[model samples]
Target: MLTFQPAKPNQLDAIMTIENQGFTPDEAATKPSMAERIDRISDTFIVASQDQQVLGYVVGPASDERYLSDNLYDHLTANNPADRYQTVLSLAVAKDARDQHIGSQLLAELAKVARAQNRTTITLTCLKKLVPFYERNGYVNEGVSDSAHAGETWYNMVKTL
Candidate 1:
């Protein structure tokens, strides 16, 4: 059974492997950045595992900002329970786990956490091709995003709690 739980420091290697596979070099978070997030925002950073193997993860920090800024990609702050918005920095499933709804499940888990915290919305930015996937998961396209991360265009996606 796949279970959702807080990300731990020991899962860093698995998380980094999936991160590299799911995103391009420029777009993927570095080891150090991932480490910082794991240490500082475990409350919002969750992983899906079964039989002691991590299959996927969804991570981000709570924020007052409604949209993701490019700076957030490199700099992260600890989650503040009082923040009104929950932002998804990454949502990735292992290659072998694709087509099994793991990504959607991860998002659902994050939504549960956000709702419980009384957050107003969950926000994320995705490449053009992934916008539809996020849309099906309940996020609305807010058109082109100003984020210049990875030098690629992104669309703002938000789901109101």
Candidate 2:
């Protein structure tokens, strides 16, 4: 059975592997950034694991802003229980695990956490190609994003809780 839970320190390697596989070098979070997130926002950083192996993860910090800023990828803070919005900095499934619904499950798990924390919405930025995938998972495309991350165009996707 697959389980969804807060990430643990030991899972960093597995998470990094999946992250590196899912995103390009410019788009993937650095080791330091991922480490900080695991340390600071474990409550909001969820991992999907099966048989002691991590399959994927959804991680971010709670924020007052509705949309993500480029700084968020580099600077992460602890999740504030009182924050109104939940931002997903990264949601990645291992390449070998793509055909399954691990990504969607990770998103659902995050939404559950966000709603329990009294958040109003969950927001993220994605490359144009993945907009429809996020849309199928309940996010609305809010047009082009201001993000210049990886020098690629991104779309702001939001899901109201």
Candidate 3:
């Protein structure tokens, strides 16, 4: 059984491992960067664990844009309650755990939190190949994203809360 919980500082290594394996070298957040975010706003960062072993995570900040700007990833600042939207900075699952719908579960939990905070929408940027995956989770494709992060084509997806 997989369980979801707020990420702890001690779990940085686990989270970093999953991140590195899940994304290409340029797209993965650095260990120190992940550590900073985990320590900064743990309430917005969560992990999927089974038997206390971290397997995946969903994390980001709440912002007032229909789609987050490049600066959001530069530093995950404090979540502002007045923000109209919640942006998912990263969502990934372990390769070995791919078929279990863990990503969807984490997304559901994140949506719940965003709604509770009165955020009007949830948004994210994903590769074109993953558009259908986010679509299945109720996110609407708002079309191409301007982010050239990792030098990959990206698409913007949004879900109204």
Candidate 4:
């Protein structure tokens, strides 16, 4: 049995584990970065858990526009905290815990919150290889992105709310 809930402070260690496992060092959301995201945790930040173990998590805040190549530090720091468009900053699951719809479930929960908040759209960037996965979930690829994470090619995707 899995439960989805807003992220809490203690879950950072576990969440970081998954983030590290699912992404490379360059692409990984590092501890400080993850801490920053936790600090910025809005109603959008969420975790997937069963019993006391966290299996996955996702988070995003509202923003109107973004630059494709900017890293989180640059992009987020330049933003007005009051930005109104949502960007799915991180969506990661434990390696052994994937293939169980956790990602889809997280996205569904995020969508519900977006609608309740009257958000304009939900947007994210993924490697070009994962474009089809997002497309399967109704996200439209707007264009290729120039990512700050070297060697990674991203595709900007969005789903209208």
Q: Cα lDDT of all candidates, in order?
A: 0.95, 0.93, 0.89, 0.78
Candidate 2 residue runs with Cα over 4 Å from true position: none
Q: After superposition, how far is residue 109 of candidate 3 from its true place, in Å?
A: 0.6
Q: Is candidate 3 or candidate 4 better by TM-score?
A: 3
TM-score against truth, every candidate: 0.98, 0.98, 0.97, 0.88
Model 1 ranges off by over 4 Å: none
Tens digit per residue, CA lDDT, model 2, 1-161: 99999999899999999999999999999888899999999999999999999999999999999899999988787888778999999999998989899899999999999998999999999998999899999999998999999999999999999
Clash count (model 4, backbone only): 2
> TM-score of predicted model 3?
0.97
Clashing pairs in 3: none
lDDT of 4 by residue, 1-161 (tens): 99988888788899999988988887776687777676665467889999989999988766766533355534444334455566787888899998998988898888987777777678888987888878888889999876656467888998887
Candidate 2's error at 128, in angstroms? 0.7
